[model samples]
Target: MKYNNFRKAVSSLTSQRSDSSLPVVALLTGLAVGAVIGVLFAPERGADIRTKISDKAKDLSDAAKDKLQAVKNKFHSEGHELADLKDEVVDKVKSKARAAEELKDEVIEDAKSKAKDLADDVKAAANEVKNS
Candidate 1:
């Protein structure tokens, strides 16, 4: 019945032009029109429907607000934890950097001491050769 009529309608629209999308457009239009008709013919009074719609909207709004608040709270708590973690990481990095700097200074001093010793040995060798 209704399906048959819908099929017939589509066939009729398609028969007018095989290369066109008139049938699809007409089908969508028909669905929209049907929805409007159905809503208009609903058994509930207009005022009652309005109230129901408003109540549903309010409920959804409240749920959304609650969810938003929960997210905000979680974000705030996480932010504090992140700050603490950042401080700890910064402290560790600073400690490591200080250690690295100290090691660099020690290596430089050791190299200078070795070079001076080598120079002194060379001078002593030259003096011995001159005496001989």
Candidate 2:
């Protein structure tokens, strides 16, 4: 019976050969299985198993915290990149708008000068006619 149980356990562990679980899940499962086996085989009191479980829980908590921090760092970096791109786009738009305004002013000035020249020509012709 013991041999059969051992074989069954080995086969189960082997069948799950693929990396199906995340790191945290895998770690938790491993700790649970180990604690159960240690309790079953231990000659001492249940206090030992309890202590081991507590230690394993602490380790899992630390691991989860590290993973969360890594994710946060990645998001922060991406956010900064997005902000920089927005600034660049705004600056380019402002530059284009300033250029357009200058062009409009130059066109208006040219039109005014041409109209003035035309009026001066008309005045000169009228004066000549009067003198004649």
Candidate 3:
């Protein structure tokens, strides 16, 4: 039961789409709103304040773009890593299955040989009793 659940969890993790960037975007938006509000309330000349606000907005835009790009890069890297992990898992399972098959064959052959030996022993005893 636990193993089935574990397999389900692993498969779900691999299949589910990660929306991890949503939180990052939301945090950046909150920061932008706070910064704008702080800038608006500051006592300063209107023109200078406007310039500062514009610069800050531009800076925030650039930062957001950089972060989004970084997130995309990391997502792609992790996808590759997952693919490699899946391949490794498949290879390991195949190897284990092959090993099990070989073991089964060995056990079957050993049982057959033992059965033959037992049969020969029985036949010899029967012949000895008949002769006596």
**lDDT (10s digit) by residue, model 3, range 17-48:** 35775565556656876877777897887899
lDDT digits (tens) for residues 40-115 of candidate 2: 9998778976888789999999999999999999999999999999999999999999999999999999999999
Per-prediction CA RMSD (Å): 7.3, 6.7, 17.5
C-alpha lDDT of residue 20 in model 3 = 77
TM-score of 3: 0.63
lDDT of 1 by residue, 44-99 (tens): 99899789879999999999999999999999999999999999999999999999
Backbone N/Cα/C clashes per model: 0, 0, 0
Model 2 ranges off by over 4 Å: 1-45, 120-132
Model 3: lowest-lDDT 10 consecutive positions: 9-18
**Candidate ordering by TM-score (highest first):** 3, 1, 2
The CA lDDT of each predicted structure is 0.90, 0.85, 0.85
TM-score for each model: 0.59, 0.52, 0.63
Highest lDDT among the candidates is held by which one? 1
- lDDT: the better of candidates 1 and 3: 1
How would the candidate models be sorted by lDDT, starting from the highest? Answer: 1, 3, 2
